[model samples]
Target: MKTVPIQIALPEDEYADQLAFLKKWDDGPKPPGWELTPKAVVVFICGGSGLRLENNQRMDIAPKFIGDRSLVERCVVTLAGARGLLLVGEPGTAKSMLSELLSAAICGTSALTVQGSAGTTEDQLRYGWNYGMLLAEGPSEKALVPSPVLSAMRAGKVARIEEITRCQPEIQDSLVPVLSERRIAVPELGDYSVPAREGFCVIATANLRDRGVSEMSAALKRRFNFEHVDPIADKKAEVALVKSRTQRAIADAQALIDVDDAVVDTLVTIFKDLRSGITEEGWSVAKPTTVMSTAEAVAISTSISLAAAYFPDSGAQLALIPGHILGAVRKDDEKDTERIIAYFDKAIQRRANANPNSPWAILWDNRHGIS
Candidate 1:
């Protein structure tokens, strides 16, 4: 069974449902050519409940990123004002997802995107010539291959640049003029240029934690409004996100949805503990080397449930394997082993001891062998 990428874009029928899920945007003015008002886009991206589509159907577009609605609101407003929107955050914080959802909702397509990397050249963000056509026709318009940004500009839609910081500063600065002047110049063919249409905009995402990231210049930054996305923090919100994500994962994995509530709680606890460096009981645990992101938690929980369903002994009890948890927590760093072990011994072990039949007790007893 092939799994499809989760569709973040809401169908027109689902637009109002999506609005209902987001916060009510009371912002002053809206951008041109937006499907929803700037305020509605904010509400759709962040978790809020005041929007409605013309159709009487109750739409249900879930808030994908569990962060502050205000932050999302600012991003929408920035795009509404035709300023570039830069989403900067740690890895796996859903920066790209948020950007994709925003672009898809705003422009009706998320496919017009540039994935930035160290090898990415100016041609990627700007325009490239089709070498075959260029050789045949000598730099005619037919030879010009417009990049995603140029296409978006001509079409008056949002263009997405993923991992903008991963591109070299030189490649990134190519957008300074496109953003500021709202046009791309092609000097090779008689100074041909594509001026942006009314609704044209750019949404770029960068990982702040990447080691080789090139900082955005102040001049370039001035062309955009930056939004920092934090990881999901509230327990109830995190649980809801995990549950929603796990359902999607299970559907994608083609696995049975036989996971237990206790198992969900346990996975959430591990994520919260490792992410925040404290247990649910407020016991401090050393930070692990791994990121402990909500995304990872959803993956681990889904994997455990699938393993239990397919494998013999593991499948019967629906019990989480300590080995799976250990593998999830103790990634990349040797020191993480000690941190995970400490967490299990001091926090999980203590809790399981108080309630002998606790679902985590099996995990607590088997932690050593698994690690």
Candidate 2:
């Protein structure tokens, strides 16, 4: 028998499988044009009790991200009001993931998104011209091309603008009237305007460390609720997230390997300590000037797992972690390697001496990657 791997589905598709269950679980009050009640939306993100399928079997849902349940609820509420929701945080903290999840749950589709960048133009947020048609027909409605935001407005669905701060201030402000008057005027198309529908809303994400992010104008800022997404705080939860996500990635790659929990723990520890500027032994290690987010931990863990899967019997290959850490820590600056070496000297060496039998200590013994 041939093993046919399952195709990865979108978040909306995943939730669609449970849409009936969501409706049955809470048929209470819902906002206009919402797929589920606000209460059920809460259950969708934070996970909940009492859901079943038509087969009379219990249906359990997993909470997507580990964060404050109240935070997710606030996002849902903001969308219900058809206002803008802005998620700002350091890179790799899952700000985009949160937006996608909320959009998937409420609107049932998260595909209407515009990736904001320095080169992003106002036409992307408002409307663009079908130049061929414009030249032939002389700027009629047929020549107007709607942007993702315009489409979301016309459809009354969620419109996601990722890394909004990366866009120029003038381009970013193109969204002001969209959120304020809930409309987009296409002057070139001869008095045509696109009005947002009942469920129309926008979700945007920005990185705190972004240098090219021209400060959002006060007019744009006043139109949206800003949420600061922090990095994973709990050590145990962070470890579990990395382990589970890395395992999923490995399995998705169709590679068979059991990434030792001890290895996962050490990786998470180093990332958290470096990110927090403190060591497990409370030693002050020089922090790398990089955004050491949990996503980076997942990447390093998955890479190690893939390597172990391919070279199960290679002892040296299994101990190549220090090399991997050295690589993961140095993103943009060569000086970051010095921070890792200094950390190895002050913290890793001390910790290894304290716990000589642990997996972390084994990793510490391989610190010559920097030397």
Question: Estimated TM-score per prediction?
Answer: 0.88, 0.94
lDDT of 1 by residue, 1-371 (tens): 99876655344334544533332333345467665577667556664443443444344445656888878878887888899998887777888888877876677667789998889999989999999989887988888899999999999999999988888887889999999999998899887888999889999998876633347777788887888888887888888777777777777677775656677777787788878887778888898877878778778778777776577474433245566667776668888888778888888789889998987786776776446
Cα lDDT tens digits for candidate 2, 1-371: 99886677778886786766787777778788787888777778778765765668788877778888888888888888877999988999999989988888787889999999889998898888899988788888777888999999999889999999989998999899889999988777577788888888899999998843348899999999988899988999899889899889988898988877877888888898899899777888888998788998899889888888887775643367788888887888889999998988888777778888866577677878766
Please state the error at residue 265 of candidate 2 in Å.
Answer: 0.5
Q: List the candidate 2 regions with Cα displacement exceeding 4 Å.
A: 1-8, 49-56, 212-214, 316-318
RMSD of each: 3.7, 2.5
> Against the unseen true structure, what C-alpha lDDT does each candidate score?
0.77, 0.84
Superposed Cα deviation of residue 309, candidate 1 (Å) = 2.0
Among all windows of ten consecutive residues in candidate 1, which has the lowest summed lDDT?
19-28
